[model samples]
Target: MKALVLAGGSGTRLRPITHTSAKQLVPVANKPVLFFGLEAIAECGIQDVGIIVGETAAEIMAAVGDGSAHGLRVTYIQQEQPLGLAHAVLIARDFLGDDDFVMYLGDNFIVGGIGGQVADFTASRPAAQILLTHVPNPCDFGVAELDEAGRVIALEEKPAKPKSDFALVGVYLFSAAVHEAVRAVQPSWRGELEITDAIQWLIDQGQDVRSTVIDGYWKDTGNVTDMLEVNRSVLETVEPVVLGEVDTDSELVGRVSVGEGARISGSRIVGPVMIGDGTEVTGSYVGPSTSIGDDCVIRDSEIEFSIVLPHSSILGVRRIEASLIGRRVEVTPCLRVPATHRLVLGDHSKVQISS
Candidate 1:
């Protein structure tokens, strides 16, 4: 069996960050989310892998060269545009010829990998198998409607009126029959050939479409909110390891992983925090669920439940939480005299005064 990983989507939801970097390359715990997916596939014993890439193909290729690091031989399949999931399969027909394959969305984070699903599909060789999780907002995802016998009867892509709360997780298992299903389906109203439609086509042909509801953690790290949450989740499992230097004046608590060359002085870092290599944290209160990237500097600040990218510096900021600071960013106190509520917002900079 082979694996097809989709890293081609233009992550508009991630805005300026995705504008500069691929969404799949965004770090969860000082590690790219795409790395985790690739590692999972390696664990499943799938060696022949094809990565579907688009505008950020060069970056993804550079990050994952031959895929030998993950014990897989990778083949890059370029998609000029990210038409849809079905379109990705359509283009990757040659790479995935006559074999069963697993399709994993690049940005999705499932806590307990897809090992079980892959094992099941390989054992039974079903026409299609998908992972689902109960989500409150089913309309935001491709939803699955199962019959009374727990069989997948129908599937819908971002339906206004969802059939069920079971939203499709990014992991999917498909046999060689999916190639035919992709060719038989038409583009949806959105002008893209939806994968949900292809799976529905398989269902209409009386194919065995299997579904599994995942109770463990799962998230699509497409936007900032989910990115931070997934970061927090990954941090929760980190062990306290200080490979760098921590001065006696500073105190480290809980499950903090200090990378090599990182220095902490006169700072109090709480648990579940990851400090990247070469970073310096001095006289700051680094709270839980925070991942500071490499070469960053944090001084006289307080940050919690946030992600600070590489080369960023936070100086003299009183407190920051639930934030995503991009790379090379500098956050300093606005030291203007009298502090007249100054803000530089979209295309305009203004200072508002109140009596």
Candidate 2:
């Protein structure tokens, strides 16, 4: 079986950042989010892979060239527009051929790899198998209804009235049987060929459709909140290693990975955290679940649960938490505002003030 990875969405929700960079290339723990999916596919020993790319194809190609880096021979399929997941598959019919394949969304983060799922798909060889997870907002996602035997009976693409809370995860396994389904289905109101609709078509044709309900962690890192959360989730598994410089005045706590050329002095670092190469943290507090990218500076400041992109600076900024700072950005203390009302704030406190 081969793998098809979709890396061609215009991430509107992550504007400004996605405006400049491809969403799939956004870093989680200093590595591109798309790389995780590629690595997972490699773990399944799928030697051949196809990546779907859109407007940001150049950037994605530059980063993942030839795919030998992941031990897979990759073919880049160009999608002229950000149509839909099914559209991506439709355009890659030549690359996919008659082989059973797994479709993975590049920007989605799954805590564990999809090795088991791929193995199961290859063994059972179902017409189609979808990964499902119970989500609170089922209406916001393509949902599935299961039968008494836990087989997928029906599917809906973001229904106003959901049949179940089983929202489809970004991973899907399909045999060549899906080619007919994709062609048989019509475009939705959104004017795109949704994969959910094609899968529903297969079900309507009495093909064996199955679902795997995973209780594991999964998130579509499409927006800032989800990106930061996924970063934190990946950081949790890092082995504590300091390949950089840590001065005697500073302290390291918990699981922290400091890359080469990074220097820490007169500061305290609390981990599950990642500090990229050539970064300098002095007289500051780098708190838990934070990722500071390469060549950044943190001086006389405090940061926690935030992702500071490469070449950014946090200087004299007393506090920053739960933020997604972009590359080459400079963050300094707000000198434009003067303290009129000063009060102590507990952690996670909320204050409403006019800007």
Clashes of each: 0, 0
Using Cα atoms with residue i matched to residue i, what is each candidate's TM-score against the true structure? Answer: 0.94, 0.94
lDDT at 140, model 2: 89
lDDT against true structure, model 2: 0.88
Error of model 1, residue 255, in angstroms = 0.4
Query: Lowest summed-lDDT stretch of 10 residues in model 2?
Result: 340-349
Task: State the lDDT at 159 in candidate 1.
Answer: 98
lDDT values, one for every candidate: 0.89, 0.88
- Cα lDDT tens digits, model 1, 1-355, are 9999999988888877777788899888899999999999998989999999999999999999999988999999999988999999999999999999999999999987889989988999989999999999999999999989999999999999998999999999999999999999998999999999999999999999999889999999998889999999999999999999999999999999999999999999998999999999999999999999999999987888888788888777766778777777777766442322221111111222221
Ten-residue stretch with the least lDDT total in model 1: 342-351
In angstroms, give how far residue 211 of model 1 lies from its true place: 0.8
Candidate 2: tens digits of C-alpha lDDT, residues 75-98? 999999888889888999999999
lDDT of 1 at 286: 95
Cα RMSD, each candidate: 3.6, 4.7
